[model samples]
Target: MLTHFERSLVEALRPLPDHRLTAIVEVARLSPPERREVFDKFGNAGYPILYQEHFANLRDIGPWLFCSGKYTSLQGQYNFHHGLSKATGDTPISWLTSALEPSRLARHLGEAATASGPDGSTHLLRFYNEQAFPILHSRQDLPGIDHLLVPIHSWWLRDAELDRDDGEKGWRRYEGKDRADCCGVPPIHLDQACWDALTGDGSSQRLADLLGSLPGAPAIESYYPNWLAQVRSLLAKGRRLGLKQQADLDEFVLFLSLHANPLRGSAKLEAAFNAAFKDAVDGNQPLAQALKQRLPPRLLTSQSNV
Candidate 1:
């Protein structure tokens, strides 16, 4: 059950402005401390209800599939960061299993496969399945994500209650004008900013300030201390917390809380770019060489940091 504080946080965190997508995209690309702060603030604790509902639905798909998205345009930003691409068939699943045995495979793929719509455009499907997941999960490794797909539909829905016959598909066959708003692009990492904003390099001071004034603020006051402490502990230890520990922790916060508008920012975009390039090069993944050629400066920057 959600505590009163959690409920309050959820209420405050909702209704994010679409323009914040630029800030989120910018921060998600940066490094640790920065990335962690971003995740903790925007993506983790401050995520909207649509995302929480979306993730809850994915749980029904079992441990292998993890779904995430937002109602706002931020979804588009996520798509760009994660590189919208498709990987049909078993190739994606096979790669996932091979990456780590099912037991070791802690990552779940988010699918947003959309179908073609009227006017030759695509209509984002309101629903998707395991088969469609792998195709879209290949992008945005910074969020420790695998793939994503947008399922499209032909019809639409204007309201929840429709006057349809019992034998036909419920609300699935509405005309173009009646079609409901279909699910669009799924956000790559919903919790990255929340995590960073909470625990990244210079975040503690801000968190402290927010905590003091959080009485009627978002849910940040409710779980900020405990959550921030745990993250700080992890960062202090700096042990092998896994490849994308910050991203994982951020996701955890979003999964557990119901904050309406905790915090959001775009301070880690460069770091995301760095991590993506490194993953491609060091891991020798599919797009490493090509990415290397495109972002030669990122490679040079990494070497300089060392």
Candidate 2:
């Protein structure tokens, strides 16, 4: 069944001029037959975001933009948008609408396919993924991001998952405005902020997944944003106090949440958390042991049982 979001989006784009609206889709999501129809057999139907000259190996699975006119046959807007939900498993989508010639828009995204981290590590950046694009669209930590957004008058993405937020999820339409011009080459550079939001030592989705999968972790259905924010906040606090190892950080987030936020609680638990952070970092004591040692068993038991 077509989702309310997809139906509404098709209506929104059906009136646009030829080449003005494009469906940003990942090739990996396309079935073999779908790939052949949209790409190999249908010339001018879509343009890939990864250039063959630079990313021949990745081109097959990279993101591609399917223009409206030829593929849809209904004016110049996409009528074939249902394929999107099929490919992305009905998750939110990233859309591109621009007056800049289709090829130019495709080239800009092709150039943005990779990124350079602040620490000097370089890797392919999937800037077009539905989950990642919303974060990319809002973050201004990198110049390359500006370059990518320059030609786009409107960028469409969603911040929340499809099933939970308001019926159609959180549809965010961003206008590219303010600050430096969007220019430059491939491999966008990233600072700490971008890295943290994008992939901070597996501290983004990976960390959330780790915690959310635990036997006692709260279900994300009703409190996705709160749960993520709480997890990140606790992880940051732990880092400040000296926790570094993955295991320690994970434990710290859990321990803090179990205490219903250690830093925000009574001065007693705060003191225990401080000692626990220090213990996890330098001393051989595990965070749980250190915290339990400092606090009474009744206190620990009450909170953990909650």
Candidate 3:
């Protein structure tokens, strides 16, 4: 009892290579009732089959996908929790709902594109899922064949305290000074150039060179603006106006001044950090009050702010 769109999507997927189809079947092995719910909820819309790829050996800190399209924007990178859930095999339907929701997807893409590194590299890998796979696969003129479902995995090497040199050939472990940990501390020591390369165009090539020179897998971290951090802190700690907090507030005010449309920017920023604010104010009246104080008077009084 599929709709026309659903039927079209299924027909598209029917011709996929056996391996690719098998993977989809494995991930989507829902019960009949659950299948009906999924079909009913998502019948009209396309689904985003998420994918991830690392630059250099930075593990999971690379760009990700929310859908498979030639023009997939950088903002399509999977959120932290979504990536973590996918990595750990805990993906829920709610997670999928949030990801595929059009408004939420647009907001996320906007934030990611705006906050991208200096090179402005917002392009991400594209992949096929049940919804998109059929459409893309049907096109005979698709540019790349290997752009299909290729799984990626990452592992971090840990330091071992003991070095055991077994007598077997190629079986030697180093210990003490001789034993070096394969995984070192996070790559918090990235120079400005490195940061530029990571966030810039051709980031993958840059990452490969960087990782080639490093001893262990580099741990990548997300960058947040100072004002955003301050707002977040105020929301979390409640109305504690220390010198640092005051400075953060001042910076936030400066940010507002710089933007031509402060209201729009504020709304986008709120959407970007929605999860954090939700966590901070959950069952915490003091934190909520602190957040209210930090917000502009206009925002507080404006019904359009929401």
Candidate 4:
């Protein structure tokens, strides 16, 4: 089934009469048959953005570029974009219009498949992955990354974390700046700024501040000297369970604070709370409000426990 981003991508990629057409399809997560269909339709001439030079044998699983000429009608849209994003939990194929030939474009992108890290370590940069692309785009002065798409006439990428023009929560777009001729790779490295955006490098300091800022941070006050780590562990669990918002995360911190190490101190209560948490997130209701049935009223209102 088509996702919410599929139509928006198709509409956005529809180029002007003079514009070019090409898109990146991630085939690694796709089933074997799905991968075959793409190759069969496009042939072996398709360019891969990630390559063996940087990715080694795993390059086969990377994204492929194809000319999407017949993307006018809905069926044509299906033909060009059709099921291209079938791979589960992967970013959708991104669109780019470049005046350069396919080979030159491929060469330019392949250069970015790898990056150097501090202490002389080399790491693969998933530059083409729209999911990670936002991280790279979030900051300025990111070595080669800031202008990686300079050669392309126009580049459009999708990010699921952002708000869309439509009322619904779906995809967001980031257009490339510095549209100049490709000047080869600029030694894209895991710089300090890039690392922070990529991995939340200074998260401990931020989390500590958050713990102090919100009264609901820890379900209980800590006698433990390593309270930050304890709260960190609690927040980690909450994140895995879909608690992304600051308020929801703080409330979850408060809830799990009382649950103890085994979580709720019993399997049965844990199960009950799990169901309630899921319901609250899915229904867009306040988490603490929903937990009223699952948790005792006195406990919810009590002072932070030690």
The candidate scoring highest on TM-score is 2
List candidate 3 stretches off by more than 4 Å.
Answer: 1-88, 91-104, 107-116, 119-306
Give lDDT per model, in order.
0.28, 0.61, 0.27, 0.57
Best of the two (1, 3) by lDDT: 1
Candidate 2 residue runs with Cα over 4 Å from true position = 1-19, 40-43, 70-75, 82-93, 158-171, 178-187, 200-202, 205-207, 210-306
Per-candidate clashes come to: 82, 1, 4, 0
User: Candidate 3: which pairs clash?
Assistant: 119-200, 163-174, 163-175, 174-179
TM-score of 4: 0.54
Ranking by lDDT: 2, 4, 1, 3
Higher-ranked by TM-score: 1 or 2: 2
Candidate 1 per-residue C-alpha lDDT over 23-112 given as tens digits, one digit per residue, 9 for 90 to 100: 112221244554454344334322211233445653322223211224334344344222211211111111110111111112211233
Sorted on TM-score, best first, the list reads 2, 4, 1, 3
TM-score of each: 0.17, 0.58, 0.16, 0.54
Instruction: Looking at model 3, report the run of 10 residues with the lowest lDDT sum.
Output: 152-161
lDDT of 4 by residue, 130-227 (tens): 43565565533557876576766555564322335564444445666534454466778765434543444345335445545555443323312133
Q: By lDDT, is 3 or 4 better?
A: 4
